[model samples]
Target: MPTHPHSPAKESVVDLLGMLAYGELVAFDRQSIDARLAPDLRRRAQLSIMAAAEMRNYQRLVARITELGADPQEAMEPFVQVIDGFHDSTAPRNWLESLVKVYVGDGIADDFFREVATLLDPVDRDLALEVLHNDDHSEFAIAEIKAAIADNPAVTNRLALWARRLVGEALSQAQRVAAEHDSLTMLIVEGTGDLAKVGELIKRLMQAHSERMTTVGLNN
Candidate 1:
């Protein structure tokens, strides 16, 4: 049977979906690497479990894309360079950095998805919403970030600087993706109903980051 050509609308939708699928794949890989920064076996295992869940979610998204007649790797290729650079450049040096990475990165991801969800149909939108990291992971991140700061108050200046650097690096990579990938950028703009909304989304992410850091005793 011949496959139908998707309309421009649907193609854009698929691209948006693909970008997200690729995001999940890269996130899984990076988090798996950062998990090694955990101080003990228990903490390591917790991070490993979270990383593995990303893989499972990635698989499901890939399967759905295949059903749409898209190549999983190809669909994700556009995002490869930016995401790869983000992870490589921000690679954590210790348990504290790792926790901050997860907290900040995942918080940013959840914000992005919430913005993108409006572009998708019901099922995929719901899937994106559902795949987000849960409260347990958030709680875990808050606890780890707080404990590390408590153990060494001197750690604050270093880790807070690390967090800001991580955010800067992430934004740099994201700007690259938005410039090079029109479809992905358009997805956010249209999906959220306006270009200005992206800034608001970012502000919300910053607010969340501040709350998370304050909860951890880090100066916001």
Candidate 2:
């Protein structure tokens, strides 16, 4: 029997899936830890629930990777360093900072997933859309951040700067991912056949981020 030719594009797809899976896994872990910083039982439980949701999403991604005949662990190993670095550098010091990190970091990740979903094949695209944050959990974060700002007003400046740093760190890691994964880079560029479309996608993510910041009373 003749062996089937492998699609080079599949390499990018697997890489993308692996990265997302690891992200969901780490997100679950970080959110669980951050929940401990919650000031009260109700808030801590809410954060725990949010963290559980990420774990469920992580399982889904892992199953999908397995379905695609890839070892999830091996696939995710490449991303461990950069992803760990992102979380370590952005570790939140307080409950309010934790909320801001969730709001900013997860929001950007969702926006990036949305942008990439357009370039994926049907199976992968659907999976990407499914794994992206549903926005329900974020309501709590948004509410908390807004309430904190209302209470102090001074923390707004601090969190606004924190949000900017989150974006900066995320972008730095993104550039590293792009440089290391050419096939994934090609997927984004070929999505519209114009390099400028990639720039537009990034601008859209930033625009959405700014709106989210303003929604929570934080200056962008």
Candidate 3:
């Protein structure tokens, strides 16, 4: 087998990296907005910290894009519609729902990224891993969800429905992202395939998400 140099991916690689960076940036923005829905200052701050991490990660991705001769904004432009749409359509109806979306949505996305990261070169792989939420931030969201449920048992039904809606919107957005963002999707396709691997990857994401939801006392 011929060993290829780790030159920048053709346009495909460039576009994929751009989409991932933009996705991180938008995720930060949306989470910051949704964080305000938190009931108190502490929880809000925790979410803000998570968003800040994303911005830092975005900077790193942009720097890498520049290194590869791509403009960061140009790299990110193609993904605005699908990313923005998912957040817009899935806007939480309340504090608990917002938490569910943050914890639940972010959890699945991170898992997907972990899978994708493995397929990248060391630098890109490390970048993908670095973009994930820290354990403490995740714990904060989880703790808040548990506390909210504990404090108001009546909220379980409402929050469960809201959680379901968030997942549905998230899955829809993922499909759109996959269809529109070829480079990242190609990474998956290369690792898995057109059919079975993609389905299985999504299944793992869904399963992991379901387990997380259950851990927080939400129904699937």
Candidate 1 clashing pairs, residues 3+ apart or interchain = none
TM-score top scorer? 2
lDDT of each: 0.78, 0.86, 0.78
For residues 1-220, write the lDDT of model 3, one tens digit per residue.
3134433344766676787788888888988887887778987887788888888878888888898788989988888888788888888777777777878777987897798776666777787788787888778778888898899888888888887787788788878877777666766677564668889888888888888888888863
**Candidate 2 vs candidate 3: which has greater lDDT?**
2
Off by over 4 Å in 3: 1-8
What's model 1's TM-score? 0.89
Greater TM-score among 1 and 2 belongs to 2
C-alpha displacement of 124 in model 3, angstroms?
A: 0.9
- Per-candidate RMSD vs. true structure? 3.6, 2.9, 2.4
lDDT of 2: 0.86
Clashes of each: 0, 0, 0
Candidate 1: global Cα-lDDT? 0.78
Top-down TM-score ranking: 2, 1, 3
Query: lDDT tens string, model 1, 1-220?
Result: 3132222255666776677787788778878888888888999999988888888778878877787788888888877777778888988888788888888888888877776675677667777787788778878988887777787788898888988898899888878878987876776776666779888877887887777667777654
The list of candidate 2 runs beyond 4 A from truth reads 1-8
> Model 3: number of clashes?
0
Local accuracy of candidate 2 as per-residue lDDT tens digits, 1-220: 3122222276677888899889989998999999999999999999889889888888888898899888999989999999999999999999998899999978988888888887777777788888877677789899999889889998999999999999999989989988987877887787756789888898999999999998998864
Question: After TM-score superposition, what is the CA distance of residue 173 in candidate 2 from its true location, in Å?
Answer: 0.7
